[model samples]
Target: MESEQFRRSWPFTGVVLWMCLALPASAVAQDEGARLSALELLIRSPQLGGSDIPRDLPGPPGGVEVPLRADASTSSGAAMAGAQAVSATTLPDAPVRPSSGDASTPGLSEEMSPGGPEGSSALLSEAPRTGVSDGAPLTLLPESSPSRSFQVLPAVVAVVPGLLFHGLAPAIAGDGQTARRLFAMEGAGLGLIALGGVPIALTGASRRTIAPLYAVTLAGFSVFGISALANLYSVVSPTFDPGVPAATLPPLELEMGYQYVSDTSFDYDHFVSLGAVARLDSLKLEAVARLAPEDGNAQVRFGGAYRLLGAPEQRRGDTDGSSLDAELFGLYHRYPTEGFIVIGGDLGLRGRFAMSRVSPALAGSFAEASIGMSLQGYSYPGPVSDGNLHEQLLYSFGYGVWLGRGGPFKGEAMIFYDHRKDGFAGGLRTFGGGVVGNFGLRGRALLTETWGVAAEVAAGGALVGRLSLIYALGGES
Candidate 1:
């Protein structure tokens, strides 16, 4: 029984020894397989193996540290060492992994890091850091090519034949929409002039209907001028970005200035000028006063306008700077040396058109016009003469440019013509002083939200210049 028991115990001990020896060998093989799998996964990873992928390697302690060298000899040495290390761990018949020859293959170097050397391999140099954690491909914007007509033809045509035809430039430039609008505008203007002019002629320039008819005719002329400018602008617009209108303006403004007038027909030489403007929702009111202390000559004029179309002065928004208004004004003048006091009233229509609507190149430029009639009577201090009521045709037109981009320093400068002969800067004395009006250049700028400056130089029968200080209140800053 003792022999049998010993034999059984010996077999059991042999079995335990065999299991202890085989278990460690099996675990070693599994670990090697897992390591190979991990290496394979890393080499095939999208982040590491792509054509545009960066060649940076994670360093030491927790990662497989591999060094890459620029020189062929150093690279060969590193490869040999890596191969040896793999061979020492694997079985004799184990397959060796092949190395890739692709330029995008990951390599270990300072050039691969985010703070890498500026001078790196051509492939690495092409990659740009896209504000990401690491490398990204560089992207460049495409350039645009301008067409022949876009660059040259339109502008030329607009100048050569556009002045008279109004729509010729845009039509030839293949802009049917703009051309159609321009043609329509021209036709409308001609029609209005005919409508008003025909009646005035048939009625023998009758005073009973001259006021309204004159106003209509002036409106027509204004429309024609606007359309002509627009035609030129439309063809030239491709070269520039358009300007935007002011979204808002000051509600109230006050002005004071000094005026010097050199007129052979008038005795007043120096005067004090005062003016004020008030803007409501859709209405604008203005007042002007000029006093000559040395000559005892004084003039006061007050007026208001009601908006019939487009945005108000205080809240224009994104409008094209186009507007139409009906205006009424009253005037008083005392010519102390001439011994006459003139009192008058006026009624008219005023309109403005933004040049940008016609073309981007003309942005910040505009056209303005007003037509009306003034009725006045002269009162003499001494009874020596005729006291008959006089009628004067009033018309004005201007071309202006906006000053300064949108900011506190916003304003406009204009070269204008005024056809009234009763004011301090009256019509030219040439040809009986009634045929030609005064031409002037005026500009106003707001230096800050509340303070500004204005200047005007005018010529006619007299040379007149005025400089004013402007103070603004309320509304938008």
Candidate 2:
């Protein structure tokens, strides 16, 4: 009788919870429309809303991103720091450094991003960027790059181990049951996944390519989180209420969506449910001088979307977009060469949504942004034979190389670490990268440039295939 009652009310409760969660998204969407309008209008008539904007809004920040807020000048430092503290909770981890039009260079990842307000970093040296040319030997200057202020990923990796050993240190020391022991570890893991991407983001700058592996690692982090939460609920039957992020301290962006990832494994010859992504994009506001945005720009945005697919999602179909949440890799760029050799590794952040959606391009490469939630489970498909996947906020971070450059015959070889349990996974966490080869029908001329087809195939993990598609989305006209 209890089970039957739960079955009936379970859905009702879930629906109510969903509706409540969606409120923020709706409100944020409205805000995005308003901002877009205001910006559009401002672009047309600067006098209209410019006067309405708070005079206190920090003027657009300038110069390179600083790692530590202490080094920041005036209140902008503290304001940006405060903003990061608040935004950190609402922001979704994004690996977008590698997604721009001009980011044609090979290997150099824009993963280690800026901290609050383009803060400083311990791993880098402060230096301005005017010389990004290839032959220049790519100096290791932190001040000149965006990685300084945008890298909030350490939380994902550090939290799990730290919390498990620290937060529950007392509980573990006591004579507790196996459940308590595992729960402590699980709790720590989830906590880390939730915060791992923070530091990386806080310190990220706009100079390098943001790799997918970093945020992808969040997937593994989520796995442990979901498991911990699920177990805790099962044992304690805790209330479904969760904490709201600090940014939305007073009012937050509510969002919701459904996304999925389906893959066909050729080697194992089986179709599997990779997972889905459902998330919100938190909006942000930054101020920079008008003289040169690239030189100094402040920005803020909010939004959220469902994960259409995971890992090999791009091969399936493109995903949607949201105005909330700061756009993760907002930097623009161009690749130096057509092809080059890069060496790196791919790490899996357990069940973190990896779905990539390629869009119609304006030129040679796919230029667009990704929006969706970080799925702790496979949101794409229904409960599979593997059982229910836990839900949590998680991201993955890993190191790897972009071999053979961006053009055809582009290959990526990376060593992947599955931080889901941090125990390290082999097959379940795909390591060997895929291949995207473009075979031009004619020469690289009028016909070929204007019209061509490309075939992409990835063999590893849960997906294996040889998919081909024609290219012509605003190409050379």
Candidate 3:
């Protein structure tokens, strides 16, 4: 009789246990739904005006819930009722997750920018909200975005339309300051060109004012070109850290080399070249000698330059590789085959300008210009009628970049133009007596504390190439 009663009670016990488990779950679902509905209604209230809040709020970890503050400005009856209903309950918090869409999409990035709804949602989801006055409105502080690592489109623009516009690259890179400066610089360059070029056109390039006007025009071109390059550099510099100028140079350096000269007018084709440089407090001394073995031709030059507005060459850390100096050089040449000797002295002012002053991207580069005159006289071995003195214009300009950022390797490379109608290279042989000067590329580097190499190639009426070994007395190791 006992076994029969126990069997009969088993089915009722199971049914009761099922009801006990199901009732709480059903009640919990209803309460969660009510909380979500209340929150959604509050978000859609007239004062809040946020109807896009998702209906299915994600559940919080550890079962903790967060409550949303209702706007204190709710005046309407429906809005007030919604606000009250939301304040009376709590909503479960959810871990914030980034959007599942492709991050590289342009539209998506724009929509997720700091001013967008997603940015606010991200902040709200990540930050715990508590201890806020109900009357105060929620205000989000702007979040700073990380700088771009590299940009290809802006770099391309920098080469194309940027060549003409000068600011397109930086503008595209979101560098408004750099863009504005470049635009201003471009405008100034155009203005200068107009200033000088218009006058020259009006005056037919008269000899009276041609020199000054020509200078102004060249200045304009320099400015315009520099600004254009700066635009490109600004967009591209994020890819790498820019190099800095060197602080010092070797105090004493000596060089010896072989030079090959190809000139139709001279019989000598091979020669030996030797040079020396000494740096002092504010004075620099230099000496050079060249000898032709086959024809007994010899040339020697000795000169010194004084720093007028810059740190000495030995210690140039004070400035950014920019300086102005006064130069004085004397030269002597003997030609056995040509039966002539030439003696001359050159006086000039040379200046270097750091490109970084124009734009931060142009660091480690500089532009140089020099102008002066040379007074020379030719002497013949035998009695010759012509004994008149000659005066030649001395001018040169070059664009140079510093080599090596650190360690023992240090030097500079330059592409340059020389205007003086002297030296082995001389001016270009033309129908008009070689008005254009020589163009060359030259570079020197110190491999160790006391050893280095220098190389040069120049072209004009003659093609000249030289490679030299350098020895230094003292410098940074």
**Which pairs of residues have clashing backbones in candidate 1?**
none
| Model 1 regions lying over 4 Å from their true place | 1-139, 142-162, 167-184, 187-213, 231-242, 355-363, 382-388, 428-436, 475-477
Instruction: Tell me the tens digit of each residue's lDDT in model 3 across 304-334.
Output: 9999987887887746778899999999999
* Tens digits of lDDT, candidate 2, 70-135: 222324343344333322222224332321111221211234333522322322224333355422
The 0-to-1 C-alpha lDDT of every candidate, in the order given, reads 0.69, 0.27, 0.71
Give me the candidate number with maximum lDDT.
3
Which digits, one per residue and each the tens of the lDDT, describe model 1 over residues 1-477? 254458879989888666555443322121134333333443443345322222332222222322333333334445444333322221223222222343334232443343434333443344332343333222211223344235477677777777777788888877786777788888999999998989998998898998788778776876776777677667655555434566777999999999999988776699999999999999999999989999889999999999999999798876767999999999999888888888999999989888756544456778899888889888985664545588888999887777756767778887787877666677775764335678899998878889999999998767899999999999553
Better of 2 and 3 by TM-score: 3
List TM-scores for all candidates, in order.
0.61, 0.18, 0.61
Could you tell me the lDDT of residue 296 within candidate 1? 89
- How high a TM-score does candidate 1 get? 0.61
lDDT of 3: 0.71
Candidate 3: 10-residue stretch with minimal lDDT? 102-111
Quote the RMSD, in angstroms, for model 2. Answer: 27.4
